[model samples]
Target chain A: MSTTTATSGRARRPKKPITLVGVDVYVITEDGIPKFDEYGPFKIEFISNRGTKVWPGYVSPDLMLVNWYRCRFNATRPVTDKDVDAFVGELGKKHQWSAVQKLWNYGDEAGFSKAY
Target chain B: MAKHVITMLPGEGTGPEICEAVRAVIDHTGVDITWEYEDIGLDCLKEHGTLLPEKTIKSIAKNKIAIKGPTTTPIGTGHKSANVTLRKMFDLYANVRPAKLIPVLKRPWDKIDILSFRENTEDSYAAIEHMVSDEVAQCLKVITWPGSVRIAEFAFKWAKANGRKKIQCVHKANIMKMTDGLFLEAFREVAKKYPEMESGDIIVDNCSMQLVRNPGQFDCLVLPNLYGDILSDLCAGLVGGLGFAPGANIGDNCAIFEAVHGSAPKYAGMKKVNPSAVLLSGVMMLKWLGETKAAERIEKGVDKVLAEGKHLTYDAGGTASTDEYAQAIIRAMDTL
Candidate 1:
């Protein structure tokens, strides 16, 4: 087996950042409790700046959601601990008690704070 | 008549012999084609330090059409498949493979003419992977709406153009709801526009069983990358084997016609392997270039030779060598 590097053989161009306009969140609940798994509790549909729905624009329910939150709002400033707190606070208000509480518990259990 | 310039990658191993055979047969049909030869596969890797060189890509890009022989890809290790790389780089999303039975071959079933439209890019072929832990690894199965819609539209258009009545969308949406579900949704969305044509969906596993059980039941099939890759080869088995399968990777701007088989390295210099796959691929190339008369001549000649059950290579259960088989096709064409 010849160890050759399989390159695209085409010139590389920088990828333009996709501008997110809005998001549709479908929250799944079981027995009045938010069901969370690898796919996350909510299925997110991202609407691009061009009004086209971005396929595969969903995010996992990990610390990555924080990055998605920042991008969705177009926050150019650096992320702060206060920003993370406010994001979780907004989620609690929008999705109600059980889901946000479960997310926070999972965050703690997964050591998301330390990782961040 | 205007001469057509085509990129010809004879590839490696038995590629050269079969490609020369196709060239000779095409010449006998009286089509004026200037072959722009390029190198790929292991030999090119040694010289250019890449499986696909810049010159080969340039030639194909300039000509906008290419006919290639089988290129070798290492198993389980080494570089990525040059075939997959070419398809991706050119955005050749639709891989069209037809399985039409030659009456003389006389397999288990007769009247098997099925065309498979496979999504050539995306899905697990994206090659995105990561190791989360020492014990676990993950690979993402990527399926996008645009990718799905384009391939579905291509399949329907080709079917309609070819006078095919039914088109089936093969998928496993029942299992991977979101990923495969998106693919199925796109197929349905596209099918609605073609109300005059019949359209339906089938699960991948069930589709496989149905294909072998009754191949005549399927007219055409459209599928995503992985499923298409698997099922297209299965369809090839229905008519004969890969030696009889001719494939095309088509996109909006460009198209590539190729043999859907591997370079038989063990029989590289023997000149005993069959050249039917590459020769049929040449027939496809002629049709793509609007040289219908030449295409028909080659097709008729091949059919005549096969029907005679003489002058066939070892794979076809005959004693003739590769050059002898090719010469027989040329002689048959002269009669036509």
Candidate 2:
């Protein structure tokens, strides 16, 4: 490897930026509205989806961590079809399913916030 | 080179149409075929308390090759699925589908071609379901080393044998680590043996996106049973739809070929709906039978008839009925 010339300019080596290490999901359920309480307070962990990794499930709910599916970030609330419809509709409108998948579905988006 | 038997189960929700469709296509060939039919219906729930009869499973065990139509898997616990029963009973490890551009139909895609070797026997389809509570339900997804190894091996061998260039192990390794993780681990282990072929891992969801985006880039994809079911259908959509998809369930000792389609109950007794999937499935059966010449003739006839698109079915944007399309295939065969 060739070293950068100190007189000309210092080469900026590529470095992975630090990111939010943990997140969780919780939803406030309004009275009289029943949610699809199928799976509750699901913990999402991130992992690389491009390369080879051991898998018993077929998709990544998270794409941030490595070698673990038990994520500290959790989404604990009853999800409604309206929410699903609105999310999908918004994704379609913006052509942003891929982006949305990163944040919520695959857990790759670095910018996840708690939803009420 | 040898005679084979194909047992057909056009189970509940779809009746006789698929059976007739398959029979019409194979009639074009000279190969010797023996078949059996099961007197099954939704009544199986009342009589046997099951959708799959013990006799049908025994028949599959004895002959090893059976073509079937879609069956009803009630979302409830009343009767288990016949498809799942057959998958478990035979340990039919690989579900294979071939989607090819027919050079006739105008679709959302062009020059599209895909082949899939899907795991047939295990996963959530294991029928290991239980009622958790009044508010929730659970289906246990079981993935074992042998299950993963068998399917992955099938993918590689199929890719190499079929002149395919790559194998993708589709998985969701993020959420359920141990279960999905085992599948990925087995793929990595098995991938070492087939360095001559390319291997890639696509997360199941992305596999969905990329497939719809650029289906032409894929060849010989391997997925577990359930995921394969969904992906193969998606690929079918890229080329045509389920009506053009042909499939086979193969074990070490036995095999069966059939149309990879659903029961269009609305078209029942109408002598309609495309028989192309089952007809091509018959062609695949011919290939498996070593009747490559007969298979070629059937496929060529299908190409010729479908290329015209005039005698096509409603799905193909034509008015031709099932019998009409079958006759078209037959007429194409006679000319061939």
Candidate 3:
């Protein structure tokens, strides 16, 4: 499909209410903690809670942000594919974390190595 | 009729007929024209040594406004770029181009109306332009806090004044920080003021892809210098062509609106040229003059003439020559 059709498709999809409590999502071992926080090279900031809520229209409400860091983070290298997989894996294996009513896990933006 | 001097730097390879068209405006308006005319030819490369002369620079600085037909920037040439020099010297921070669906001309998308307020100075357009090395020549991308804040502030103000609904700050800060990052940060700060308008920050790459795909979703795009230049041209294409796209170079004390397209040398001297870009730029100039009523009349005339969809040059999908199109617009003005 055209990029328009795809982006419009993405824009219109209904999103479930989800929040990334920065505390849990950034646990050191599950996903590498962002340590080089020397305010980064510049003040790249997350201005709003813009992406945490996914709008996955007719399909199931996507709890996971399609672009994982869409939850908001600031850095130089950009949030990578490996980062997404780690977040999904960490949430999937623990205390029914991935299936929380307020949030659910879609495929990690990184890749499709099945968690089941 | 308030008289204002608009300097035209046709330089070399400028066609004869285009000169007459510009002269016609001066004669018709009966305005004193301060012709900042100079033969900034190849010799200019050897002497005071620039494609754009210090004389033209002083004229723009003194008048605070000017217009031009076209200027050729020879690629890989030793001479510095005239346009880049003026844009930087005057600190003309914001390059504002309005892309409206002209009354006729049958556009592909109705929902597309975008005003691009591109950062004019820094970024790759800084003309810090040099060959970094034999294998890897480079242009620096320097995005600053003040640069970003100024452009973002202008975009929001522009949106507020024009009744636009949304604003999008396009950048590639995801990878290139320090420069693009500063712009993004300023957007965050300034955006807080205009809560009325919905806002989103898009990666410059995604914005480029989407603009061609769905020009509809966008309204106002504020970006760094290079992205603005590229995107504004794309917007010009959507409405009709660069011929219909009017642009304004604005700073704190001054504003210069002009024909955004280049001076097409091959088509020079042949009255078969399109003056839509220059005339539309004139309309913008009037608006800048605070003569909104005259600007409205000019715009309405332009709309009616084009809506009739006849008397258009090659670009506007009609057989009419340049003068014929201008005549139609003048007629539209009289009827109004």
Candidate 4:
């Protein structure tokens, strides 16, 4: 009868290390691709146009605008939110990107091998 | 002994031309002011890698008082505004702009005299913007309780000191609940202590309408960063254009007085611009320095020149060169 206990009261578990981050930035362009550049330490895995991956990779050209771009970067080491924020902050200034979002890669690896 | 060691920046383009006008008035004051000139804006940027050099910061820190010309801020996205940089550097949290009819300038509202206090440091002026997605970009509007309280306190204290009867807080709290809410909340708290002055809050849009409809009803107004930025300019238009508006960026340590107008690069050497804004700013600087006599003297001289209506810039509806208008003010001081 007491076997089923409430899990809602349990403390939140710690988040896994950030292995990857997806930053969404707004720059005004119709093509939606940032000029490819070495990000230093972190490698730019791919860039996406709207929702479709467009760089280091390709999606249908019909679905891309040059102004908005989502750049995904791969980090060898697990990154903290602070690290991601600071990294994005620097990148934002350099490229004058209007927005940035950090996406984490954890749990299991999926797409890279299949895409490669 | 010199009353104050003030830093004077001639700035870029027409800046130098108008600054000379202020210099003439300063000389007539007989305040024995020691002037330390500094280079800033486009000229300094070209010579140095940065728009705001370390030397300029150090000079303001040392002098604690500066009177400057309008530096050119590039339109669109280029170098960040030097004025914004200086404001952040010194933590100049209060931007005070007083707009009043000068009798010389022909305007609809002759009785419009509004003293506006704008919170300078926080809100969108922080410039912390980032793109959340390529399609969605966001600039963070930070409104802290301390920032709000300090600005409100400054407004109330200023109102009490200046004998201003009513103080109005301008905000868009209904739309921006949290940020603008914090601002209005703090303003109300600060307004409580100043029982002598009547205080109220007006939604920014309505305040704009009221300003245009009946500007005489407003005695003093306090606003958050972006609203203040737009409203101050609108208030400036009530009396005259930016050419007639003088601004003071003040903090605990330093105060910078300057014309709120832009540097008209096309008319750099033409000397056909109004120097009233910069000269009035000098009057403000003198007032801040406790050299009230000198301040009043300069203001009266300016009043005389404006009343004479003979030697004025084309912008002010006359045909006097920049130097000629300044000479007129100085000559008026001689009579004072």
Query: Predictions ranked by TM-score, top down?
Result: 4, 1, 2, 3
Best prediction by lDDT: 4
Better of 3 and 4 by TM-score: 4
Chain A vs. true chain A, TM-score per candidate?
0.23, 0.22, 0.20, 0.55
Candidate 2: segments with Cα more than 4 A from true spot: A1-116, B12-14, B41-50
What TM-score does the first chain of candidate 2 have?
Answer: 0.22
The CAPRI class of candidate 4 is incorrect
In CAPRI terms, model 2 is classed as incorrect
Among all candidates shown, the one with the greatest TM-score: 4
The TM-scores of all predictions, comma-separated, are 0.75, 0.70, 0.68, 0.77
- Summing lDDT over every window of 10 consecutive residues in candidate 1 chain A, give the lowest-scoring window: A62-71
> What's the residue-level lDDT of B119 in candidate 3?
88
On residues B218-246, what C-alpha lDDT tens digit does candidate 4 reach at each position?
A: 88999998999999999999887998899
Model 4, position B26, has a per-residue lDDT of: 84
Evaluated at residue B24, the lDDT of candidate 4 is 82
lDDT of 2 by residue, B1-336 (tens): 237676777664444776676677776587788777764546466688656666866677677677776655656434455555455445567888888876766766666778888888667664433223222335556576877887899889877987888888898888778988899899989999999988878899998998888887888787877788898888888888788888888877667676666666677678778877777877787788788998998888888988887798888888998888888887888898
DockQ for the candidates, in order? 0.03, 0.01, 0.01, 0.03
Number of the candidate with higher lDDT, 1 or 3: 1
Per-model root-mean-square deviation over C-alphas: 13.5, 16.2, 17.3, 14.6
Residue-level error in angstroms, candidate 2, position A64: 36
TM-score of 1: 0.75
**Tens-digit lDDT string for candidate 1 (B1-336):** 349988999999999998998899998887888889999999899999999888888898888899999998888547778898778667778999999987877688867999999998777775543332222345557677888898899999999999999999999999999999999999999999999899999999999999999998899999999999999999998888999899999877788899989999999999998888888888888998899999999899999998898998887889898999999999998898
